[model samples]
Target: MTTTPNPTLIYPPKPSILFTNIHFYISHKPFTSSSSPKSNSFTIKCSGNASSDPKNSDGGLKNLLSGIVDERVDELLNREENRVLLDGLDKATQRVEIAKRELAQIEQQELENKKMKEYINQLEIRAAEIEECQKELLEARTLVDEAERSLEVEIEDKNSTMTETEREEMYKNKERFESVKAASVSAIVGTLAGLPISLTQAANTSQLILPSVITLISCALFGVTFRYAVRRDLDNFQLKTGTSAAFAFVKGLATLGGGPPMELEVGSISSHAFTGAVYISENLLIFLFAAVGLDFCIKLRILSPFPIETDVSTTKVD
Candidate 1:
């Protein structure tokens, strides 16, 4: 009796008690028994949440990863912005260079146009000057031509007047010469007519008549004497006797007749009668002939005409 002391009745402990204890035990035991396993599971879940949430692992490790990702994103954004800015800057520089080049080209074109216009203006001015010079030259040539023509006309008129004057002088000279010749011939005839008479006689009573008759007789005697002398000389020399004989016959006929045929031989008389006649007649006659010849020489020289020459220069006109 004491032994199993109501093992059953002992209530093995009251059932509530047992259940409560069991519950306590079970709760406590599960906590104790699988504490390590549960801790491992909880750890795994926490790791998974942490990994999935991308929130935290080691504090330094989380910080490093966050910093690396942030730095990479910043680098990409900065690189893109820098590229855009560089492109903008390059485009602006190119535009500036193009503007500079265009400005230089416009300046160069303006300079060239200015130079061309200046050259054209100079050429036009030169052309006008050349035309004016040509006109002046033509005018000068025309003036020269006119002057030459006037000079030529004047020279011609002067030459004509001189020629007319010379012709008139020549005509006057010819007339004077003719008159002088007539006078000389008359003087000679008068001398010959008086020669024989002056030599024939010296009688005071018949002085006048004697002189006239003696002049005629002396002329006849001189003619006969000259004929005889020529014939004698021809015969003595055996030279051309025909002329001498003819002269002698004419002299003989003159001596037989009383005519003027014997008067031609008045220069040949040498007898006293003939010489006296010659002295009275030929002395004055010779003086007269000499005077007439001298006058003729002087007058001819005075009346002679000379030639004149004229020269003129001329220019051509257009």
Candidate 2:
């Protein structure tokens, strides 16, 4: 060869072709001596589908590797231990999520407890203020009660001093009035008693004067006696009746003894008894009239019901 033959270039297999499922078979033989010089030859055979196109070979190799890897993963997952490990991993993830939720709830509970404590503290403060207000009210009430009692005592003392002067003034007026009333009543009643006797002796005016004077004096004295007698707390009707009767009987006895002279006669005892009865009966009617007049005056409120001294003394006790 004058010029070196052009060098042949052979490229290596692509990565995809290397991973493809391909099988190769090779056979070698030596030539026999009778035929020619010794020489060796090979028969090459390939198994499985191998593409000649580069793009197709790469795609087919990629598909074949993907399928084999999937089969191997399936076989590994089909084992019981591997299945249990996967299940355990899923459960662990769920437990982590649950723990995060519980932590959030715990934080919320703490916040609620803080709020409750603050509310309770406010209530305690309010209760203390109420107690203090109650204590102040009680003290104020105590002061008011003491002031009222003191005012009452002062009023009572003033009244006691003032009443003494009032009583003295009242008693003086009553004494003057009572004396005048008693004298006026006695004078009028005495004049009425003398009128009947004076008319009988109307012929001699000088003779009428003595009897009239005597009757007037006796009636005046009787009024004084009556006033003293009734001063005692006794029944009005009984006292008036008894006083009138006694005065009438005394006047009758006096008239009987001091009458014109009479000679002794038969049946003198009966005559004296009858004459005494007649004189007593006449005087009794006049005294009874005076008693009734005084009682009427009392009922009409013209006279005081109680004795002057006794009434004044009993006022303070009442």
Candidate 3:
């Protein structure tokens, strides 16, 4: 019973048909592993067949090597495609960041431009205010100048009125003084006229003739001095008042009435009449006549007149 053959231990010769079938199977379907099928599948097939037959092993090994090379090339190509995709993603992200930065910069520039525009507007408003203020200042100055001119005109008018009033008051005072002087002169003339011719004759022949002659001469001298004083006072008043007409009128009236005349009354009358005629003919000559006449009267009063005997002796032949 132990003499039956163990089929598992029996070694049979490899058949050509079996080797050819194995080669066909290896060529069509190389050994595949779950973990790394592309790299290990061809290597397993080549190693398994190399031990089976020498002639078939060489061809199988060559084909397995070619398949392994192709698998390695495919793995390299897949790795390259993944790397390109990652790089593209990174570039896209960088472009997006750059766009965001550009947008922020543009926004900042816009904000700055808005601020500058507002500042320019404020400056323009301030300039307008300054112009308005300047206009107001000029207007105020013009008004002040007009007010000053009006005040000056008012002051001039007031001064003119005051001067007119003073002139009127001076004229009134002068008229009153002339009236009093005329009344005094008339009273003196009336007192001299009351003396009788018989009394004058008795006084000339008697011992009292010297005293009477002296008294008459003194009276005549006093009358002449008083008349000249009144005329000089009136003339000075007229000169101060710049009224030559007033002085000329007083002189003409006094001369016609013979108030300041003694024995040479006709000469006095003729001279005064000539001066009055000259003053009436040309009013501009009044000032000169009044001045000369007033000066002559003052000089006549200052210098004593020569006695009648001396005058007669001088006229007679020595």
Candidate 4:
């Protein structure tokens, strides 16, 4: 009797393929048992049809191999191995961060170096300016030294030939000449001071402010010159001072007499005589003034008619 082959039961299969130089197939098991059961999927190495190999077992051998391969893959992906790989990656990232910070510091240092270089350049320029000023000061000092030397040499040449007595006489004569010149100048200045007063006094009454102001200005000029002349002999200075005072005093009468009122009242001849008298009296007063003050200064030991200087330590250079 021909027995009918048991009805082949086929279930839908899940298949997976892997390709490289060779291909692998992963297949889900076929269910043929009357008892309902899920089949395990297994990886199979294949060149051609799986039915050709009698050694290829249905599920047992392939399931065992797939289980071993899956366990090995899971071990590779475990927490310890993954954590070690993550640590290595973190270390590389930290290295990159450190390099970036170092690069920034280096750039900052370079900028600071550039600023320092510029500051150094400015300091060098200022130093050069100071050096130039020092050089100029030294040059000016040398020139002044040379000029003082020349002046001393000239003074020495003038004084060398004269005896002490002769030098004294010469100084006295020079003093006399300077005194007379000073007295004459003072008299002229006094006369100028009085002229405005004289002119305005006769034009009805007028303020004396103009004459006073003129005298003040003239005295200022003379005072400045006199102070500059103080290094000269004390007797000469006293003579000049006394002459100035006396001239200012003696010119008062002339100024009063020469007013417009007097000019109108008196004849030209009377005016001429008055002018002559005033001029003569003014001169006499200046001489008397100089003699009195000179004597006073001498008595006080503030002046000397004959001052003696001796001892020449260094020869004057020409």
**TM-score per candidate:** 0.28, 0.41, 0.28, 0.33
Off by over 4 Å in 1: 1-81, 164-318
Of the two candidates 1 and 2, the one with more favorable lDDT, higher being better, is 2
The TM-score of predicted model 4 comes to: 0.33
What digit string (tens of lDDT, one per residue) describes model 2 on residues 1-318? 011222352442421122322432211112122544443343323234346677986786588658865975776677677778879999999999999999999999999999999999999999999999999999999999999999999977875767666867777788667655654566467558657856775678788777667666666666656666776443667888898889889987787778754558757766777788877876677666666665566567675533666656676454
Count clashing residue pairs in model 3.
Answer: 0
Cα lDDT tens digits, model 4, 1-318, are 121222353431322222223223322222133455544444444332234344654564567558877975565556575657768899999999999999999999999999999999999999999999999999999999999999999987888866777756766675555444443444355545455544645454455555545454444344333423433455475656554555455454555455544444458658756766665455445334434444454456544333212222122221
What lDDT score goes with residue 57 in model 2? 65
Best by TM-score: 2
- Candidate 4, which ten residues in sequence have the lowest lDDT sum? 309-318
**Model 2 local distance difference test score:** 0.67
Candidate 3 error regions (>4 Å): 1-78, 162-318
How well does candidate 3 score on lDDT at residue 150?
100
Candidate 2 vs candidate 3, TM-score winner? 2
Model 3 C-alpha RMSD vs. true structure (Å) is 32.0
Question: Which prediction has the highest lDDT against the true structure?
Answer: 2
lDDT tens digits by residue: candidate 3, 36-75:
3332222132111124567676776588669866986566
